[model samples]
Target: MHLISQLCFLLCAAALGNAVVLRPRDPVKYQLKTPPLDTPWTDKVGRSPWPQYPRPQLRRDVWNSLNGIWTYQAAAGAGDVEKSPPLLPYAEEVLIPSCIEGGISGLQKWGVTHMWFGTYFEIPQEWNSNERILLNFEAVDYEATVFVNNVRLGRNTGGYFRFTFDITDQVKRGQLNSLKVFVFDPTDDQSIPQGKQTKRLSHIFYTPCSGIWQTVWLESVPKNHITSVDISGGMDGQLNITVHSNTRQPTQVKVEIHGLESEYATQRWGFESDQLAKISVPGVKLWSPDSPKLYNITVKMGDDLVQTYTGFRTIKSEVVNGVRRPILNGKFLFQFGPLDQGYWPDGIHLPPTHEAMVWDLELIKGLGMNMVRKHIKIEPDLFYEACDRLGLLVIQDMVSMRVHTNARPSDAEQAEFERQLEIMVNEHKSYPSIVTWVIYNEGWGQRTDYFPEFKIVDRIRVLDPSRLIDAVTGWEDHGTGDFLDNHHYADPQCGTPYYSRLSSPYDQSRIGFQGEFGGLGHRPEDKHLWPVEGAVRTINETYEIHANTDSYNWRAHVLLDLLKQQIERYACSGAVYTQTTDVEGEVNGLVTYDRRFVRVDTQQWRTDIQALYSAAAGRA
Candidate 1:
């Protein structure tokens, strides 16, 4: 009977032009003239390029992932691009979501600032009956102009934020649809916040990437569907939810909150357009790094249903033992982890696969670190999701650009930065793991004027008051924001004058943190290393290591002891270790550049970290 049913289903699918059997074509492999260090996920890129659902926070089952291969061409200028119409054939094929400068993209040739991408996809007949067809781009670097079926959809600027266009009228039903994208990126131009990207790669600065560096997809929704849902946790143990709809119709919004282990509560409320639905979970389990509890949320309104999840916890600054420290869930707990710069040797800005991303966070957990400072670059949404599930706290940094000496941005550039800041907060506010936001790092792309820093801090606080803000991470403390962050390097035991500088008077209300410290270098003999021009230590200089185990033990002991001392001597609330893994030329990481070797013993590190957490909690 099962075989008969399967046969009938196959017959029905065949009758509908075999559309059910049709799937996205396998991505083509691009042979780069110069290859990068091979990772576990490198070979999988051509077969399945980030096959997971792009958006995990607000999920819909009825959507198509527009990832895989697409036709690509490089244009010299706008005039040269104007020579061809929309949906024009391309000279070569490049993998979507991988930048042209990377080995995975097939076209590793750099120096071309302007480029075009084109692809053809057939819309599922079932999705053609919706009132709105939205074409969503998870992210596109710098600037982008999109076209569908030879009709110009829209233009978007800002490389970090996501954007969407309503292409319901532009697409044809039951036919193949055409998509064209034009991208322009002026990396390190000083006007834009290009993060750590630079045209010329060097000691600190890395290679520049352009065009669609993230996922692109299409979804169908009702005319009066929910556009967005914002969730936050209150100290009073209540969940605050605001649902925004596209249409101004009165509708019933049902919210069901389910604990990961058990069912919690279900409630229905009348929502009109944009309405705030505050539901109280009487016995909610507060989320923490050790006990990361999450509640699955299901929202239903008429025919529109969306799924999401949130954690119940609170973060604030309070006086503990005569020193201002970060209080999570009304308790003083010291946060310690690595300054995670999300970059891959093979994928560059993009991770090779979802598993590789999860592996990084899992390693952090295995090492017993409770928090991670995501330095400079804003990662894809999947990264935040992994943090939430794995119980790791995140301090997200706004990507900085043009970090030259005394850099300043124009008024328009400042406005663009602020706009992207708001989008970043709104999009990822639901995640319970993100407890803080780092606005600027070491005065990169920051104006010397006080008003600009004041405005940025005020805007971030206004957007989401639940999370703490580090207005500036390293130098030039504005005396604003929630934390006075500092960066110290080399051996902490040397006891340089920098320790005395940490005693400088600052805001009494804010907490203190060593934003970056402990860059002890160690490189394996077989590891791939980028050429460094300057005089720097290639091996462990502070401690003599006769063997590999000695290297790992000495590095871990010195760093962990320094953190314990920092907390006791300076009343420091938190500290981010220099990095999680080695990158290109930088060999100061707990793990190797290719993630093949972890210097520290996982069991011993976890035991040491637990002792630090206990001390900060006032239990020891």
Candidate 2:
């Protein structure tokens, strides 16, 4: 059988005009370099970049953060299951939660496919009360397999979702316990949902981040604790609460509602079953950009307790004045914000600090924008939490892959992509800030063959009926879903005609949305700009800085005014600007890549934005 397999491999190679199989060569050793650029928080990143509790939705006071320095070894091949975990007195150290390729990690090395991360932690004496100790990773790039004291916990795939393991049995009570993680990230070399990451960075695609890129921590909970929480049905007076527990045994759960507004009193309700229950808010305060009201919820099941917050709001597409538009809280409020690509010069996918994350959202709110399109990348839950708290509506994009648009993915790849997509929706649907789900972007990895019959968008709707779904962000629109979307660059345009690349024409039945527009890049100052060595520079509408008129700001206002006129001419609901910040090589940003400077006049732009919204309201 071995000989036959070898013969088949040779025959296939010959057919493909390629050489036969050979032994693998030793992996290349790339020199690591420190990044030149830095954010405002870089100097203050300190020992722990992310010290906050990883999971804000499910809060617990009894927890320990495992986010500091860790030793890591890198290799350039697919991980082997037969190989044992590396025994370490490792020479190199990387800051936990930052990708190895990131400068904030202290080692900016690339081309690493297989990586091993090792650290140590001690279990507190207070956490030994018949509780299950859970080891949680906020996110790991591509694939990760965790181990404790050489005992393998399990494996988790997907780069942008949180994964956890119950490590009660593996951890010691008082003494130190060793933790090891094996990570595999092939970047564009493999067929996976990688968003805008590419090994060979060019144009829109930027540097690829491998290994852990978010927070890691530990939490203690009861054996029968609540595993998941789903908060929905905010449209009506009642809010739906679904609690998923570890055990299937019948148990009673108590829910306490604390209103953020002082006018309402705390309400308590008891449920006979842990699965699902509907609780009524005494004063149903509809959450909107104008009035963002949040309610704190506490769930208690015997010894297990968890806290989370939700807002009462509803999102839908309805016809107003003969044009379909986004109706938030049953009102016609035009949504407009930046196309936020949550990348940092220092941390890559992960921001330098939580304050850095909030800074972008705060800037958007301060600019008088009501919504932001999180372009083709899933941010950590804290980002969504900030949006929720700051009253900015979100249009979340699913990560795109490197798959060919004309062909179908392998059965396994298709299943995995859908699985990650489902997980993204399931995990983040509870956030009231997220009102729309963008399933595809510009046909990046979209499968055109699987169209009308494609149940992926339908599945997302079933998973989350509360949010509007963008079936395809820019192209290959199936004429289904909630919005008719298009992408225009350098300048703004409406989604009425479906653009040139889209498969179908505009559907008046759906809401018209300009997915992307108005890049309007300004040349960065020498000290503030990212080093342009091997970076690919694509020329757009770039302007020079002028002190008198501020040509950059003037250009931005002109384009925004044009956008307003186009929205009125085309009768579109809203639009997303090119981006919030300039990514690597993509200079079209309202803010620079390093978060150092703003290209536009903030106060003037805020006034213009208010005028845009006022124009939209005048039509209504």
Question: What TM-score, to 2 decimals, does candidate 1 have?
Answer: 0.89
**Highest lDDT model number:** 2
Q: What is the C-alpha RMSD of each candidate to the true structure, in Å?
A: 6.5, 9.1
TM-score of each: 0.89, 0.91
Please, what are the lDDT tens digits per residue for candidate 2 over residues 1-620? Answer: 25663565455345434445432321122222357678888767777668887777889888989998787777445645447665542347778888788888878888888888877678888775688999999899989999886689999999999999999998767666778888989887777999988887666788888888988999988888887889875757688888888886668988888863567677788885456687767676887887788888898887888899888998888888888888887877889999999988888998888999999999889889999999888898889888988999999998987843445566677777888899999999999989999877877776666663148778987788898998887777777788888777656657455456444466888888888877766667756667766553442323322333377678778878877786666777888887799887777777888888887788889988887787788767
Q: Candidate 2 overall Cα lDDT vs. reference?
A: 0.79
- In order, candidate lDDTs are 0.75, 0.79
Instruction: Name model 2 segments beyond 4 Å from true.
Output: 1-33, 79-81, 260-264, 403-408, 452-454, 495-504, 536-549
Best by TM-score: 2
Once fitted onto the true fold, the runs of candidate 1 whose alpha carbons sit more than 4 angstroms away are 1-34, 79-87, 248-251, 260-270, 491-507, 530-549
